[model samples]
Target chain A: MNISAKQGERFAHAGLALLLLGLLPLALGPYWLNLVGKYLAFSFVAVGIVLAWGYCGILSLGQGVFFGFGGYAMAMFLKLEASAPELPDFMVWSSVEKLPFWWEPYSSLTVTIASIFLVPIPVAFIFAYAIFRKRVSGVYFAIVTIALSMTLVVLNIGQQGETGGANGITDFSTLLGFDIINDAGKVAIYWVEVVLLLTATTLAALLLHSRFGKLLIAVRDREDRVRFSGFDTAMIKAFIFTVSAVLSSVGGAMFALQAGLVTPSLIGAVTSVELVIYAAVGGRLSVVGAVIGALLVGFMKSYLSEHFPEIWLFFLGGMFIFVVWVLPNGLADLFRKILRVKA
Target chain B: MTFRRGNQAPRRKAVIPAAISIEETFVTFGIFVMQLFNGLSLFTILLLMALGLAIVFGLMGVINMAHGEIMAMGAYTTYLTASFIEHHLPGLMGVYLFIAILLAFAVTFAFGYVLERGFIRWFYHRPLDTLLATWGLSLILQQTYRSVFGAQEVSVPLTTWLSGAWEPTETIQLPLNRIFIVALTILVTLGVWYILHKTRWGLRARAVTQNRAMSSAVGIDTNRVDALIFALGSGLAGIAGSVFTMVGSTNPGTGQLYIVDSFIVVVFGGVASLLGTAASSFLIAQMQTALEYLMSGSMAKVAILLLVITVLYFRPNGLFASKVRA
Candidate 1:
């Protein structure tokens, strides 16, 4: 395809995506709108997965740790706001004499917002660097991430007095004095999420089409060759991992705001792996495809679990096998092939 | 300090009273000894699971995420056998445990063989894809078990001979079941070692693992080797699962509890060495047990995980990794 034709197709695609998202609020009730917002929250993680796992070849099975870091930060702020002048209910129940030092910073909205990136970005960078710097990749790297996520889940559950344990930081109705549970607030949050999602998708697209993205693909295909060419391959891998971490953190913060709670279960190994499937199903190489994948899969899961709870896993698991075996490049590729689009 | 239960309460810095009793000291000693045995039993289970994982990974470079589910298959097989013996072969109750172990191995071995032939062979070169695919298979298997056996946990009833503990000391009652599990692990380990070293198939397996092209050129059916080794590794996991029933109840999700830990054992031991897998499992199990004595169980697990990741940072190939050209 020529440049003008390709650009025209891109515009058409973006226009369709916008129209679809714009129609949801008008077409659906408050309840379904809220659910799509949750799926949009997850798409952020899926986008990050595309960059890190798809481009950089780092299959981190622990993105949930970063997601939780963002989520818990947001939750702490909301909880503190809800229970101002007194400890959060769980803390009081657990007989904590004073608010933990970590919880103090979360009382401020600015600090809480900053913390979504401030904490997880550094941790993600350091963790990814530590492993990639030593040339650990592939299955080993994946397993290490799994262990990391598991550790976080255990630690979060173990520190019930401080972290809200398995029940998580729920029972919060307001965010910055705005009643979040109301339908108006829910619709507002949904639009805000949609705007943010579009912004992230565009930014990710720009990044993936850049020279750095080319280098990332090179590193994925042949890291040793990239290293031999004087590139610090570890730094390259870590950078994208950290970038993906940032996206996941933002998604997680959104998740807390929209979902009304953040729990340890949201950041366990199982959830992390599930996050990867969102990218895999969408087409790991396509930014917008990942968003659609998350929405599609998320909708299927919600609908299936509610209606046919017994067989949802069968469907989900079947999708995984089918994607690996047949639809390796995901739905985007299938669509492209059907349309006879040139790569 | 004299009246304190050893390893139960965390140590405090407060000065101890001088009126200590010898019996109290003996009890503390006994508890410590019991903790060590507990670690041994955990180490055995980890080793069994990791042995199969390491072997499959080393030979074909395929990550079998369903290996844990395969182990669960063994546990369920044991559960089924126990129920069958209870219903039809009541007179053979004493020997049923032994029969179940062999049956579990046979069942999972055949399952592994079919799984590899049907699914795993396609992704031999795509290790990461294999990981995700097998993970999907694991979820499918877990759901299948849940549908068949229900979500509730099932336990294999121990024979009359296996139920009681040995009173090594007045305070230290070592469970007979745990001791039996440890012995079973040792026997299995020796059997695996003997097969790998003495058998012609073992030679062919090692040859293929070391250099597949050469093995193929030398007229060894490398695909057959791949299938057989995969099955054997799965059979080892089956045995591990069978033994697990004596220690804990079997649930559809039981395999998930061990999958991450076994992966750690395989990675921490280095992917290439069987001896490394064993050593790492022993190290991790002991470290976790010791840490649990000093802190909460969850914290202990976190500490071990952090320690393993930290160690991997410096030694990515694992602590005992043999030098390979890659």
Candidate 2:
């Protein structure tokens, strides 16, 4: 397609972004590369936050529910594959005589993949419809999401036989004949995850750069004014929230593939809140900034927990304070001066 | 943990799927009473935390996640006071808890004052910023506690008067501390209610809550009111923590444990209504206690939270929401 000079410049920036992403796999060794692959998965969730929180102004503290949903779905599929010719181990342990009919669909790779994309849409829609229809906004929405997430975690932990308990759905062996535990396999999955993350980021950028995106911001700033303008504000808010949830779910599914285990802890209150914090530190409003932020926070968590275990919490906490007080816009905004224009 | 485990008979029945006998029904009826008693102890903690939360979240619109840390500081203060009594003032060991409660209030009140002046003031009118900053402060406080006091849970030596239970019936024995806590919550709630309804400070606080600009215009010094009411809320949380030491052990992360639950209670009850908060905490505690007998611990929690969410769906403003909230 022919493009103008301004459009060409934008494409160049996108190309540069891809180039930087490409350089990462080359520079890092296999282990660090795999670790970064995990971070890249997290960026998928962060990118979702840029849309949900930054644009829609709906801070979903419970996105982990969708994340966990995608993860458990992926893990179930992998578990079914690994268990080939027998039922999953948890079901066996719990003395389940028959394979649960519900899990039958996951036996097919196509169903599993489709579910990774589809499950969160209905879940987000129902939740958003219930609350947003009533015009619940701001902190109340946050509390609702947090409560939902915590409920999912508890449900996962409690339903051990059906859902694999607190240890979660683990012992994944392969994904579509790709052995995930090997070093070569790790890099393969890492690339796959990185690509998915890039796709997610691109999707978020497209949404954020659209007129729908500006309307989302308007709803955030003045809901009454926007509603008075004859826009079905609830539908717009619900639609964005659903998209964000589905994005997070894909991230969670990818994370399950990379990490080779999906636990309820991933869907807990703390992890969900941390996702938001990473998005905030990256620049909540900027899609690319959030991806970088997730990587930085993930690196800090791993690096700090390794070298300075005791100081890690303080450091992360301090980062939270620093981001809030000194850099309200995040590390993303710092480069805004050099760019000399808003993205 | 104790409340969750205390009623094991109900748990065994819950795990057994579905079967009930006439004798078992009679026992279940008694157990319901027992669960209700156990619920009082749980409710006491919820009420204590929810009251302070109502003041901060409902009245002021601050998303102060560190409110739990303030409560934990109070618990730590009690632990310290009890230790001090046992070590230095050996003769006053019996009287230490009273002093501990008072000291917890003063310490947390001052801490809240400093926190407001330095950190909270900077983030005024920004709920999201306030939320993140307070959460950061919570992590810092939790780590500081871990550094200073170590990670393990510690119990304060209870005075003999506070220990032991009263057997009001053959199968039901209620812990004295829990009964005392319920009584204490009543006293605290009444004190808060009276202060909000009757006194000059309460008037100023209410005026500011209803309309900040108008309150300031009337020479009420709304900023001072914000700071004072916040400190009062923190101080109330401290007292809650002090009372909590009687029923539970104190640890660095204990605050984090209850922060979500406290928020749920306050929000589910209705943001600004003290009576609603009171009703919701009692209702939630009873549900949790009774449900624990029937399901797994996490499931019971999940069910209770689900119930709250369902309730919120029907009444998004909460059970007893004030009409004026933005």
Measured by TM-score, the strongest candidate is 1
Candidate 2 stretches greater than 4 Å from native: A1-16, A19-21, B1-29
**Which consecutive 10 residues in model 2 chain B have the weakest lDDT in total?**
B1-10
Task: Report the Cα RMSD per candidate.
Answer: 2.8, 4.2
Q: For residues B1-326, could you state the per-residue lDDT of candidate 2 as single tens digits?
A: 44555465566668554777777766765676777788888898888888988998888899898999999999999999999889999999878988999999999999888888788988877887788888888988999999999999999987888689887665566777778888888988899999999999998898898888888887998878888878988999999899989988999989987888999999999988999999999888888987787677888897888788888888988999878736
On the 0 to 100 scale, the lDDT of residue A62 in model 2 is 87
- List where candidate 1 sits over 4 angstroms from the true fold: A1-5, A8-13, B1-20
TM-score of each model, paired residue for residue: 0.96, 0.93
Return the clash pairs for model 2, or none. Answer: none
How high is the CA lDDT of each candidate model? 0.88, 0.85
DockQ, cand. 2 = 0.67
The candidate maximizing DockQ is 1
Interface RMSD of 2: 1.2
